[model samples]
Target: MRGALGVFIVRPNPDAGWSLSDADNGEVLVFESGGQAERLAMALARQAHATHGAGEVWVYDRLDRIVGRWRVAAVGMALADVDETAKAA
Candidate 1:
């Protein structure tokens, strides 16, 4: 697990159904159906050039427990930052 990972704050949206914030790049991902969250995550992973073995998207709860992981290629800067954050923490 690397890059930016946080427990997204979610709320109901009038236009959409649900909205997740504090995601990658401070963007909000809206989902119409239940599985759209995963779809949005997959798209984010693809954009981040993630494939497998190197880095992944970890969705966590408020307790910092991982709920899911989306595998992708290693992102260098992102990984380094994550490492630094981990060391600091």
Candidate 2:
């Protein structure tokens, strides 16, 4: 969250399905499944990294637990690692 050019979050919607939100832009998208939401979030993060430099994607479970994470670096590389130490602020 410190140096990210763009941050996206994927979480469950209150009503139904999953929701993907662009933390930087305040844009939201809904998907029928968590997998679909997560996939789109990663794709958007990759595009943001390619365009602006760095990006991050955070995926949360139904209980609001951080389940997955991806960080796209400025060097056009990405790391799909789930850092257990990362906490939502």
Candidate 3:
């Protein structure tokens, strides 16, 4: 889970369910539902933040538009800051 500080994206798979990818490494994981993919992405982002002091998770809808974004700041800071702008996008 914890590896490097980077962005994680949860996006719909073209042929099926959902997928979570590490923006830094191109590693991908597939899940049956968006909720499942998002949850894992958030958990991984949190772990990365705890390990590296910063991390981010971006959730995209089926249309490939970013729908949600969560960012974790430096250690001891809030675990997540949900960006309202992403919802607006």
Candidate 4:
């Protein structure tokens, strides 16, 4: 909801696929497949970005391996990028 907000994808010990959560709250859904879970997370992140603000989403596999990080875009550049630009000015 604030700075460096994230929705993380994880695999709980008991589940066979992927799970989604906000960093504020851990492990929400124990989904059936990686593709399904990640797609849903992406949609959720985009919606949040649209309503709240820009943030990030990280995807992970069932083995707890990170897939990649996604930038949930609202309008301008990423916050870190903006900070870097200001520092250069």
Candidate 5:
């Protein structure tokens, strides 16, 4: 069995955003920033990896054309990045 999580661009107009969806579910999430979409994709990818052992995450434009993708090979990168700050005062 194979599952895929996709992040698609929505509202091709000036207010363009991204949409996240799955082949198994109808639920969708829309975000105003690509970072948000990527974040969600990363989360989904990680979940899929842990649960299914294999899966795919994709990013598409408003035209439904694939623009980017992350598969099992890149699952490691799917994990969210941590931020660090230092005080020198």
Candidate 6:
């Protein structure tokens, strides 16, 4: 919500299976389970360029259910192309 970044909401299901929502772009839907939150968060980071922004990921789990969310750094990094030197800089 602060800036442009990928978002994913994971929900568990018994019949249809886990639900993956790409709230940021809303252009894709992937069905998966087991560590779904981690997967989605990684995907979001890849798309949102988290490594560049020093972006960190947080996972929300309740009752053994995973719901992933992406958080981008407001300052520090700008989500640009990440490099070792850049990170060190």
Using lDDT, give the best candidate's number: 2
Mind giving the per-residue lDDT tens digits that candidate 3 earns over 1-89? 32435778888999999999997788999999989987888788778888777678877788876666778765422434345634333
Which of 3 and 4 is ahead in lDDT? Answer: 3
Stronger candidate by lDDT (5 vs 6): 5
Each candidate: RMSD: 7.9, 3.1, 4.9, 7.1, 11.8, 10.2
Candidate 2 regions off by >4 Å?
Answer: 1-4, 73-85
User: Which pairs of residues collide in candidate 1?
Assistant: 50-72, 50-73, 51-72, 51-73, 52-72
* Structural similarity to truth (TM-score) of each candidate: 0.42, 0.78, 0.75, 0.62, 0.61, 0.40
lDDT of 5 by residue, 1-89 (tens): 11333322222223567666665565567778777876776677667776767655655556645555555455274421112100100
TM-score (C-alpha, index-matched) for candidate 4 = 0.62
User: Can you tell me which runs of candidate 1 are displaced by over 4 Å?
Assistant: 1-18, 21-24, 50-55, 61-64, 73-89
Estimate the overall C-alpha local distance difference test score of candidate 1: 0.47
Q: Of models 4 and 5, which has the larger lDDT?
A: 4
- Which lDDT tens digits does candidate 4 get at residues 52-83? 67555665444555446666765532323433
lDDT of 2 at 21: 89
Estimate the TM-score for candidate 1.
Answer: 0.42
User: Largest TM-score belongs to which candidate?
Assistant: 2
* TM-score for candidate 3, residues paired by index: 0.75
* Candidate number with the higher TM-score (2 or 6): 2
Q: Arrange candidates by lDDT, descending.
A: 2, 3, 4, 5, 1, 6
Clashes of 1: 5
lDDT (C-alpha, whole model) for all candidates: 0.47, 0.77, 0.75, 0.57, 0.52, 0.46
Give the per-residue Cα lDDT of candidate 2 at 60.
79
Write one digit per residue (lDDT tens) for candidate 1, span 13-83. Answer: 66646555544357776777536665555555555554333333444344443444545544332322344
